[model samples]
Target: MVPDAILQEDGPLRPNLVTVAHAQYRVRAGALSVVTETVALTKALGRVLAQDVTATRDQPPFKASAMDGYAVRSQDLARRVNPATLKLVGESQAGRAFTGRVSRGQAVRIFTGAAVPAGCDAVVVQENTLAGEGTVTILSDGLKLTRRHVRPTGQDFNCGDVLLKSGERLDPWRLSLVAAAGLDRVTVARRPVIAVLSTGDELVAPGEIPSGDQIFESASHAVMALIKQWGGKPVSLGVGKDTKKSLLRALKTADAELIVTIGGASVGDHDLVKPALAKLGLELSFDGIKVRPGKPTAFGNLKDGRRVLSLPGNPASAFVMAQVLLKAWLETSLGMPPRQDYAHATTTAAIGANGPREAFLRGTCSLSSDGRMQVTPFADQDSSLITVFSRTDALIHLPSGSEAKSPGDLVDILPLDRL
Candidate 1:
């Protein structure tokens, strides 16, 4: 039997004993190993860009009016003339331009987005003008503000200018910007397909009636939901039995960029995940982490280069581990920078010292009477308490070897769900 390699606080670092930081580094290092693909701008939302996108043409392409007004030469307004009245020579509407030039004492009736007529330098907003038959009167000398109500050529972006850098995720606004930049198709990182697998013969499908000794499978679904939320494509691979044969078959058949298995990662006799994976040429990176509620979490790569992360069977443990580890891995694969939402707050209640393993206690985060952020850890921290986990909005992190904390002690908390 292979000895379980656990990372304890006081012990020296071992190759097989992984700290959360070390595991995160491994995931980030391999994140850019995925392939890239070109996608239409219409379908690029939530996809990470694989290349810097530059503007193909200048925005506006030409000096254009920003308001429904008359385009006049600034010199026409500065002339030592009375009332500054200028004849309306022609009209310039959107999509159509006044081909004739505007000489002194002449203005073109232009609408918003209309190209500015040649020889014109500014626009007189209709609000500041009095319209008359064949002529207009400037009320406040709008031309004094240079290029007033005119969007200059390349005002928004210039041709060949880099509008977005590589590794930025495309959102609705970014997509709109890219479209405006004259790109119909964009190159982006291929969305990583993650296969979520739940193990244990004692677990049954969610809608099915469980036997006397069985529990409903849940963590895998939650994992899949999270993957989808994070811009990944999640494929569910159902439940794996306890036997090595079943587990091995499941691992071999999954055609995914990453495989996440829930359950059977500990040292119990029936915990056959490690042994089964070994039989299939699995190279273990870290068999265990130094964190509570997820100490049994394991990560490795298959011989074919697909990464595998195995989580404990308990619902709360599996969910927390996925949020901490799997989320980071997915972000890295998607060409996004690794990020976590952590908030520091004072504890509202006294807390005992943590054990050797780093502890992440589920808790509620709220504002105190003085408007300071505060967190209250629940009394029970059992890994099986799925209900408590569901209601928690934060994970109060207690590092290994931490001493008892008082009510006002500051703590780091990872925000969960919507904050």
Candidate 2:
């Protein structure tokens, strides 16, 4: 009999997720062939920044009044018990500054956001002052003559300050910040092209009627949606049959940097993804992971240096692996740091003892009675069940060879789809 190791398709390759993640995804940081483009801020939303954005000018550019009141030289109003009166010089409204400087015993009418007139060190709110025809009296009642009502220049941010760093996603608020920084456009990383392909002749494309032995291809559709959400432009390669020729034809058409092939990664006779890709000179990184529902997940690089991530056929399995590994690739390709959303949550019930493989069980996280976050893993953890996956908001992570966990045991949880 042949030794199992000698007969193994991938030789002695078997690694946990950590080794693969660090070697391929994390260690090789920065970006992959980073192509930058100058896009209008209006259309920059959901795009990754390729360059650090600095402020063109100081925010509030001048010392302005924080309230609508009188801008005065504090010395004009002594700290005596009696209120001191000052002559009205000029008014400073927003966008209209008082050109003349404030002399001794003189006050300027300054509205909110107006620049503080020169030689003025304090602003008295209208509520704390008595307005007159030609003069304003500072009420001694509760008025403290100081710079409290003044907003110093560059209070928010100084000129040349790095408002947004590289690799930041230009969301709504981030776009607003850029606009405030006097930028009409921004330099951002080009969205990586991630081709989502599915395998097997038993899978029929959506919008077509499936035969009695076939089911609609759903994994690719879901993965495409996720890819778009993660800032990758996803293209569909449709369904490839079990034949090596058909699979090779479909694979050759994928001109993307990363091709995520769903299904046909196992050792079954119909499993032809690896064999077909091997014809194209695929160097396998690892044929299997030490994780349930994704043990068949495989990562490899072609002769042309393009990488392929093969996932299981089950929709739930494909989705989990995509979240775990595919997102890391997408982030690094876009020059963004790998997001680690792992958190600790107490289990609501006693979890069963885990086997040899690390498990990511579908579950919901909620606030417990004592205001603590708790996770409840679904009773049925069948990999093929998309219903359970749909209702799940978090993945309850259980390490390999872990003992059965009792209620209230803290377990690592990964929030799903930014939930």
Per-prediction TM-score: 0.86, 0.89
User: Per-residue alpha-carbon lDDT of model 2 for 150-259, expressed as tens digits?
Assistant: 99999989999999999999889989999989999999989888887799889998889999999888889889999999899999999999999999998887888888
Model 2 misplaced stretches (Cα beyond 4 Å): 1-31
Please list the C-alpha lDDT of all candidates, in the order they appear.
Answer: 0.84, 0.83
What tens-digit string does per-residue lDDT give for candidate 1 at 59-113? 9799999999899888778844455778999999999999998887899999999
Evaluate model 1: give its TM-score.
0.86
lDDT of 1: 0.84
TM-score of 2: 0.89
The candidate scoring highest on TM-score is 2
Q: How far off is residue 154 in model 1, in Å?
A: 1.3
